[model samples]
Target: MDARPSAWIIAAVVTFYMSAALVMVFVNKAVLNSTPDLPLLFLFIQLIIAVVLLHAGALLTPKIEVPPLDLHTAKKLTPVVLINIVGLVFNMLCLRDVEASFFQIARGLVLPLTISASSIATRSRPSISVSFAATIVTIGFFVGVAPEHTLPTASVPSGLSLFYGFLSSLFIAIHAVLIKSSLPFCSNSTIQLAYWTNAGSAFFLVPFILITGEPGNLLALVSDPKWHMSTLFWGSLITGVFGFLLCVAGLLSIKVTSPITHMFSSAMRSVIQTLLGVCIFHDVLTTNRLISLATILGGTMYYTWLKSNQPPAQSQRPQADQEALDNGDREPKVGWQAPDLDEGLNGKN
Candidate 1:
């Protein structure tokens, strides 16, 4: 029984995942730009919508079963959920502040950071090629954000947005490392983990929403006669639906492709995302920023190539955990692209 997926199927899966992912970013950016003051509220609504959709899917199909949640398992998953939500908050804040074209460059260190976290987690030293690639990525990050750089008005990503991007990358890296350890609590099921993390994240968000006074902001936004309710309402709905679709697309991508193929698809997504951001949002794309993207992409691709060529024992993620990385189906969703083990665990390889 040959189990290889057909080439057309792979192409279809990659296209679906990329399209959903790209749309997710643009839609979220549109909403964030419109309601810059309500990042948490926006994210809270998306989470709720995704949760509702998951519930609906679970009820309709055997493929989408979510195990019942209990206090014991919840306690075990608390750290994962905490990391997930924190990563999400930072990602949203970063997106809220930066141009969508610059967003990927803003978070350019994700590959290297993930490598660092994975190294620490696995207690492994990356090969010289991997270390060199990390250096390239770091250099690209600096080049992209060089001091006194000029572009269109308000084009420079603020220091705060860059800081948010860094923190978001850091938390995402940590989540990638820790999520493997956190999976047994969910019976090694990514679907179950998804339910627990999203539901728990949404549940835990209420107090913060209150503390941040987003509820009041929501009221003001609603009462503002000049504001278009339809934009906010419809934008949220579209992104939420695409967010769920991104999860399913991600799952399909994983089941049908190798990490190397997935890495290439991600590279393509980054390119398309930048182009689309310019076309749709009129984002400024400076020369240095372009160089920064190419350099970072080169380094990550080199890392992926190196890791994939290594012996399977060293290069491959543990089967159970690998599934969770791509499983927007799991905790790290939208805006946060968790590097595959091929890139993240280059140290281990």
Candidate 2:
């Protein structure tokens, strides 16, 4: 077995896991329709993936040459780093409330809004065209929102969830942009930030788990198994592998057509899941659903196109410079970078 194939297989696995998670969670009806752990979930999944990717990375290290960690050079970055942690918590909270499918929809909505918000909030002038494109996506999102997939008009996470979810996405986007912005200054900030955020989030969640997560039930949740494998087994697998895979894969894989990408796929997952539910599981799809589906696909196509074309975004340039300057690069460099475990998380928006 040549090591190269295994390396490619790992990269491919991310995409597979992400797409497969939709099927797994949907089939088991474990979609975070209400209450999912975003940060802990991210921590759980990323920990496993980091292990796999890092291990695989070592084998490929001779080939790829990942950079070494730099010391935390500047003190000014502390505030943004703190904000990143808070953002992660809110994102997790939002994820816990919504289904994976709808959560994905919320994910799609956040990409555009984050850029626009950063421009105004930070006093940075992002591209008007990108902002306009994002506006279209937002409008399309609301157009796509249907009563069926939406929360009970007055539900906690439904309307509120969407708001928080969108906000969470913004935070994440801001974090991404912020990370990329700050990357230039230190050269290690992106990876350092990732490590810190993971540890920081764990620090944050530890108290929550102790205070709120019942040790007995959690143990039971892990040890207990049923229906061929226990809920604990499946949940762990879902939480640990499937969730991480979906997210990491989405992040790592090639920038192909959005139809295949999770942005659209997440939304697509809902349609297929709903269709399967109605046809196989005998779920219902109203006329409104039919139209929403079309609208979502259309809007997603537009957003996806924007995302795809967004590489040339004139707006993110200054932010990217700020990022590279902060992360580890002593020299000036900006734009997108790859996604991976030890290094590769930070990239252009």
Candidate 3:
């Protein structure tokens, strides 16, 4: 099979990924608003749904093979799954407390945080332009979300909400770097990694849901007759379906393109979501907020352009056999190579 996809394929996958991501955010926000107390439970349900869909896809399509899960892979993927759960939980918490428009501003921090994590993890330094762009993005996020900058009539996010949003960005940044480092163990298949991690997340989230006392809240919600026809119920179902679609599309996008591309798509998705939030939810859009959003988007676009203009870096490591022949350093016979730091995020290569 040709592992490298065509440009059309990349375009299609990115479009699908961005569209699904945009819709999923709104769905999650709606569901979280309708049932503010069960954010973790809602995420747990989404994970379950994603697991089911992934398994079904593998079973139905012979071409899409799911690697067997063994002890070694499980141990390697545990941290990734745990981090995913934490990031997701924080994301929901932020969504529950912050407006949809401001939510993207919070998430805008992920790019800089991811870059910082990557630099620390792999000893890789981004170009000066990339660093400068990251700084601009950081400033933009602050301008967009700071409470003091808002008009007196405008509602601002609470300190707690901003804290949750920051945590969400930090956790997701860490998750991205960890997933990148763990990709070699997963045979470099984003689909396979996504499936196993999602399954593991579902497994781990079970105990968390129970410990958080969400099962009782879930039962109460389900048992209430008035809840059946409410937005909560319908929104949950919609988000569940969209959640699976988003994961699949996200994996495909990362598979076909670089993580930088994925980040750019995410930035664009944030732009669309912010517009939708303003229109659909009547979110308070202050002058500073708009300018901040523009700054973030502009920085992201400039970063993307800079990345595109740069030549691909040469590989620093030789083949294992070659290395052994040259340096007489015998390494383990693990047929894995560290993926390019610039290529994909969150094990997407």
| Cα lDDT listed for each candidate | 0.65, 0.42, 0.65
Q: For candidate 1, lDDT tens digit of each residue in 1-349? A: 2356776898898898777777878888888888888888777787777788889988899988878878889888888777777777787788789888777743466656655655554444445565676677667667766755467558877879889878876775565556556556777666676667667777887899999999899889889998777877998888777766665565456546632244345545666678788899988777886887787688767765764464433225674544423222122321322222111110000
Residues 1-349 of candidate 2: C-alpha lDDT, one tens digit per residue: 1122243564365346345545444433443332232234434443444334434544665632233434453343454444555554555555456543344444556545444434444444544444454454455455445555443443223667677666666555554334444445434433333434433334444555556554543455455453222443455455444433333443333222211222334444445544554555333445554665666566556654644443333334685554432122111124422121100121011
- The deviation in Å at residue 33 for candidate 1 is 1.3
Q: TM per model? A: 0.80, 0.57, 0.83
Q: Model 3 reaches what TM-score against the true structure?
A: 0.83
Clashes of 1: 1
Of 1 and 2, the candidate ahead on lDDT is 1
TM-score computed on alpha carbons, candidate 2: 0.57
Task: Give the Å shift of residue 192 in candidate 3.
Answer: 1.8
The per-candidate count of clashes, in order, stands at 1, 36, 0
Give residue 118's lDDT in candidate 2 (0 to 100).
Answer: 42
| lDDT (10s digit) by residue, model 3, range 129-149 | 667777777777777766654
